[model samples]
Target: MSLWKNRNFLLLLGGQGVSEFGSSITYVAMPLVALTVLDASSFEVGVLTAMSSLAFLLISLPAGVVVDRSARKKLMLWSNVGRAALVGVVPLLAALDALEMVHLYVVAFFVGVLTVLFEIAYQSFVPSVVTKDQLVDANGKLSTTQSLSVVLGPPLGGGLVALMGATRVMAVDALSYLVSVVSLLLLPMREEPPAKTAGFSWDAVRRETAEGLSFVFGHPVLRKVVACTATSNFFGAMYFALEMVFFVKELNAGPLLIGLAISAGGAGGVLGGLTARRVSTRVGSARMIWVSVLGLGWTGVLVPLAGPGWGFALIAVGLFGFSLSAVLYNTAQVSYRQAVCPPELLGRVNASVRWVVWGTLPVGALVAGWLATSLGVRETLLVAGAGGWLAGLWVYFSPIRGMRDVPTTEPVTA
Candidate 1:
């Protein structure tokens, strides 16, 4: 069936797309606001970022439990509302000339907390609303929206910040959340009931969490996917933390240039997501995964090699985007995981996998900062790039490389 025929998916995609665009604004605006407006140091900015992801790591498992128990729609709605309210505070404080780095940090923390909940609910809800046959298509379309948001969000944010100031740009982000909340509220489907257990107990939660972890690590397919994904995310986080430094110090690129570079990467992501299905069909899922991992990892190597000119920087950004095979890999992996996992365990499983995979980001960011400070930004890029490439080889050599497609029939329990 055509993707557009599914109204629930449409609303979900639309809301998520809008919300992501807003997030992209904050992603760009936050550091600029901290640095330019608040006159914060690199350390302070790092703290803000670290706090953001730290909340995700801390709250992920709990959020998964909550998502499993609660009405997913309500969870999504409340998440967006909470995020909007928190983001709105920034602009309001700025208008009163009372904005402080502390205020931004607090808002960032709350937003991150709510986002973890929203994401858990969203991921869990997808399989319920769409059939197994539609999983990859659903993921591809969602990835496309995300890619578009990435492309549009930075430039739009930059323009807004440039015109009305960073504070006002945050207001736009707040509005986007409100829109997302409404869209989710309008979704036609209800979430599947959570799996029933004998009773609620700490042991139950522990067992459930462990089950999810085992599913990811014990299964041959999931094991390699997780390894490749976790390793790639580690390096990706490092690149993200240090990209601004590379632009400013190594390339002498300004804010607009940074936005442009990000937009270029977004363009690549859009391309990857759009063609993911065809690529998977042509090359096979296993081969596609390997290609994307290698491509994404190698892109980092070229970052440090870009010349100190806009033309060269743009090329680097485009290549960086082109090398990002993760979007497709992630799309495929999520779909496969959803199809094979018991319906009742979806939330816990998704959350558990995400917790482990994403848990490395902060560590990677910290390492990137330290390495950049000690060895220089270029050297840091070289190291991260090399490490990422080596990490990709894990998937290349593993069982994941041999699998051709997700099982067409229901997966038998191990």
Candidate 2:
């Protein structure tokens, strides 16, 4: 049962592939725009990054309610359109010399808002397009596409930035959304609607949000995973928020070099993803989680040690390790979550988990910015590295560490 043969799944794969590629380009372009064009400091970049995740914290639960109650295909389609239009505004304003830090922040926030809905809908939608047996393979393939984007995007984005400017590179991302929109339009699958609610009210919102929280907190393994990931994201934000600063300001690397290094590191993710299921199956998915998480954190320390030409190479290795470990851990965990959770609760459960895990990103970004300003780039990153390693401790002590694999027979919540 190769997913490639599944016409509907292929459409999803194609759409996400193109969209992720565009988004990856912006990953490099956005920071460069702020740094090279606007002269934004590390703190500002941190704030910008944090703002992007703030919507996850604010709207995730509500978005989950919508996803559970509404047609996911429609939700995903309109969200794509919304994000496409929003991203286009950046380049347009930049060309007119109207772009500012505030514009970037606002755009990031609103885009985040749209992204939350799209994410919840997409995750909920995927299961309907494929059989239960295909979840791991499906998720792995998706991760592989993301890795490919990481490999292709940074280099492409760097070239675009080198030629025109970082601000102009966003147009490509805008177009990528349309590609996704078309794929959605092509899909012939019908989503099953949830039971109709009596009416939307503040009480319903609270109850739904609470139910998601209760499920996660009640589950031992999921709770640990959420805590560990949230903690890591908090510290990882500090490291990532100022990563470009370290490369350009400290290492004296150019945009092309930055892209190359990122791409080089992405190669590890590609490898990790291609082999994710194989490795997880061999080693046991549960054990692999802690192993990968610890490896991600410890190896991340190598980046701060980077100095110059050769130093960039060292940093690339660190990035490679981080990406590799992340792919392995994500493939295992995401598949586990998808498999064990009841389909009926998918939207709320996923949204609630994201709200807790991704919610920490804003705080992390803000803290990273403040730390970089007050302590120093290397010092802040060093602290982040330490914090990253510490995140695994929560899961290490959890029931998950003793398990072998994710079970499909019963909900983990039980």
Q: Candidate 1 — which pairs collide? A: none
By lDDT, who's the top model here? 2
Write the residue-wise lDDT of candidate 2 on 1-414 in tens digits: 778899999999999899999999999998888899899988899988998899998999888888888888989999999999999999999989999999999999999999999999888888888876677778878888999999999998999899988998999999999999999999988777576365888899888878877887888788898898889888888888988998889888898889988997688788888988788788776677887887575888888988886767888888888888888888777777788888878889889988988899999999888888889999998888788878989888888889887675655564
Residues 1-414 of candidate 1: C-alpha lDDT, one tens digit per residue: 677988888898998899889988887888888877898755566567666777667878766766777788998899889999999999899999999999988998888888888888888888777888778878888888888887888877777777888888888889999999889878877655666534668777677667777776777767777777778777777777776666655676656666767777778778878988887788775567776767565665776677776446644463445434657777777877887777777787778877877777777777777777788777877777777777778778877677787654675454
**Model 1 lDDT, residue 216, Cα:** 68
Off by over 4 Å in 2: 410-412
Off by over 4 Å in 1: 197-201, 311-324
lDDT: worst 10-residue window of model 1: 314-323
Q: List the residue pairs that clash in candidate 2.
A: none
